[model samples]
Target: MKIGIEAQRIFRANKHGMDFVVLETIRELQKIDQKNEYYIFVSPGEDKCLEESKNFHIIEINCPTYPLWEQIAFPRIVSKVKLDLLHCTSNTAPLYCKVPLILTLHDIIFLEPKQNDNKSWYQNMGRFYRRIIVPRILPHCKKIITVSYFERNRIQQTLQLPEEQIIAIYNGYSKHFKKIKEPREITSKYIQAKEYLFFLGNTDPKKNTPRTLKAYSLYLKYSDKKLPLLIADLKEDIINDILRKQKIEEIKPYLFYPGYIPNKDLPYLYNGAFAFLYTSLRESFGIPMLEAMACGTPVITSNTSAMPEIAGEGGILITPTSEEEIANIILELEKNSNFYQQQVAYGLQRVQNFSWKNTAQSLLNLYRQTVTS
Candidate 1:
């Protein structure tokens, strides 16, 4: 079977969730099915990750990604590729690709009414498109793929699509995420992180950054503990200003804003953190939760979305609105070392279930089914 994958987001000119997912999925697909040929359709400025694969070929569609480009030009490229099936990992696939289409809608956070990081207009526009436009286009596809059962259900209900059409493909942590030898010098550089709680993800509304900060503030109120609160850096300057405004003298020193920690350095951060805090309101699949757990770090995340399914019995689940409740859980984890160790053990055990190899195999089957049907 010959499949075409919309690979415009691969490596993304910068490392991010969509980039990681696309890169890892393609690499795993190459390992799993050597016979099936894949045409990765990358955008003008995008780079290919499958250069070494014999069965994988790069089809450079030198066009922009959105608006007029996607609506007007992408369908022509799909027909030109002579693809049996096309898998779109990005949101809003071409309105009418020539072949059968399979789309991966990571999350419907954009569908919600709220906005964060001053992206109100973009989010509102996307929400409108997802509700009004996607339904008409989706029925033209053979199947749909989502990162979690939560997102699968959301897609089905929102689009009024069939349950069977949406397949839940659980996200997997990279093998490189496992605990590695920490360089003594690197460890010494961030000595302040000894008892810090690490928060990943960009500081956006969907990520629930304000709620996380509120919870951290509550944690400081009653506890004698002075553990630092380390926030991963944001790409937006406005977000930085917002973060700085929240930084009062009491918690200012505890706030570590390390900008764009490389993937190589993340495992060490995970291993070193007191507990990984994931306060996101929604996630198609919480990859950071998986990464932290795989690294044998204890976790605390909201009970909603795919968090409960990912965290299993490993982490503490708190209500996002309750700052006091979030703080109490942090206190519990800190005060009772036994509880912390237990959470770590459970996290490591739960993380054993996800594998990129299995995810890719299922995807391969879907491609073959679309082609042979």
Candidate 2:
């Protein structure tokens, strides 16, 4: 069978959750399946991360815009390929796709209320695009894949889709995420601190950066140990604005905002960190927590969303809205050595259940089932 997978943004330099999901899953599929012909479609990008194997083809489509790439150029190319199935690894897919469509809707956060009025032109445009495209394309989808059961339920209830139409498949972190022997060599490029709390924050409101900063402030105010906070992917100016609004400017000196930490250096950052803060207000799946856990770092994540389910019996869970709850957990982890060690162990064990191989195998099985049935 011929399969066409839309891995449009995976080749981009700064990859996010969905990009890695497509990249890792395809890599695993290449390892496991050699019989079927696989066509991996992507826009022209500088990072040519994925290579073409005998059965697997990396087709780079040159288009100026995402809409044009997917809407205009994509269909023209795939229409000629005569694919048995087409899997779009992102939330939006071509409305006029001819073959059986499989869409990985990571989350319906854009469809949810009180969303971040993101100032980013690219992000807001993407959200608007999803809002317009998702409802139209969902009905045509043969199978809809989501990152977690929580998100699956949301898609069902909110979108009014049948349960069988949507299925939950967990995402996995990279194997490179495990504990580093010595992280300082790589981490020194970002910060000189021997130990610090690592938070991956952005201007996105769901990341709950303002409240997390407030919680860190409380930790510094109350606790004797005032370990500095190192935040990644967030600009210095934006962070200062958030801190200023939260009235936690006192914590500025303790902040290490190098901004936009390279994805390659993430494991090193996790290895050198005292703890990983992943207290997002909502997440379909919290892969960063697993990444931190896999790195032998204790993750302080929110009790909400799929985090508790994914956290699997370990790591610190706090009420995302409560800064005091977040602050107390941070302090406790620092004060109690035994508890911290136990968390590290729990993280390592929890990660065993998730892997890119598992995700790819599930997808491969789904592909066969859909094409046969």
Candidate 3:
């Protein structure tokens, strides 16, 4: 079988959930299967992360914008390759493609009602693009893939698609994420404190940054020992704006903004941190929660969406909206060493259920099935 994978943003310097998922799966597939030939379609990027294997081929497509790239240039390239089946790793796919299509619709967040809040132009544009493309491409796709069961149900109900058509394949964290010995060397370079709470945040509204900052402020007010927050991928200006809007300027003293931390150094950060906080409002799959667990770091995430399903009994679950609850969890974890250790143990055990090898095998099966059918 000749398989084509649309990993448009995989080569980009800053990779997110979907990009990493596709890349890791491809790498795993390379190791396991040499029977089928694979082609990875990507835009030009600085990071040449994936090496070309005997069965895998990397094709670079250049376009001015994402829409033109995916909608126009991508299909043209795939048509020439004569792929038996094409897997669109990202949520949106080309409206018109020659080969049988399998789409990994990570989340249908855009299909939900729009929030009347300030959002970046890039965020709004991407949402708008997905809104237009997803419906058009769904009927054309042979199978639909999602990251979590919660999202699978949501996509089925929202899109009114048959249950069997959409399959939930859980995402896996990289093996590189584990308890790092002598983590101070990594932490000392990024942050001032020897110990601090870690949170990965960005401009995305779903990240729930404003609420997290409010919760951290409450934690500082009540706890006897005030631990500084080490935030990654968040700009100082954005943090200040959120703090100002939430009227939690006092959190500035206990805040450490490291801007953006690379994926390679994340395990050390997780190992050195007192705890990892990921109380996002909604997520299809909380990859960070799994990464934290894999590193043997205690996590505090929201009970909503797929977070509970991912965290299970592994980490502390709290309501995303309740700043009080989030704050209390921090204090509780700090005060009780037994609970923290237990959470870490549970997480380490739970993480064993997921791996890139499993994900790759499932996808490989899907590709063969799609081609044969």
In order of listing, the candidates' clash counts read 0, 0, 0
- Candidate 2 achieves a global lDDT of 0.91
Structural similarity to truth (TM-score) of each candidate: 0.90, 0.98, 0.98
Q: How many clashes does the backbone of model 2 have?
A: 0
Cand. 1 TM to true fold: 0.90
lDDT of 2 by residue, 1-373 (tens): 9999999998899888889999999999999999999999999889989999999999889999999999999999999999999999899999897889999999988887755557777778888899999999999999999998888898899989989999998898899998898999998988888999999998888999989999999999888878999999999889878888898888899999888777899999999999999999999998898899899999999898888889875557899999999999989998999999999899899889999999999999999999998
Q: Lowest summed-lDDT stretch of 10 residues in model 1? A: 183-192
lDDT-best of 2 and 3: 2
Model 1 bad stretches (over 4 Å): 44-49, 115-133, 183-192, 235-249
Give the whole-model CA lDDT for all candidates, comma-separated.
0.76, 0.91, 0.90
Question: Candidate 1: global Cα-lDDT?
Answer: 0.76
The local distance difference test score of model 3 is: 0.90
112 in model 3: Cα distance from truth in Å? 1.2
Note each model's CA RMSD in angstroms. Answer: 2.7, 1.0, 1.0
Tens digit per residue, CA lDDT, model 3, 141-259: 89999988999999999889988899989888899999888888888888878888999998888888889999999999888889999999888899999999899997797898988
Tens digit per residue, CA lDDT, model 1, 1-373: 7888877756344567877887788889988888978888766554444575799987665555455556666678778768778888866687766688888878767656665454557545657776665656778778888888888888889878888888888877789888655533454454454567888756457777766776787788777876887777554454455557766345555667666776767788888888899887877788888898888888899988888877776468998778788889999998899998999888888888997887888888888777787
Off by over 4 Å in 2: none
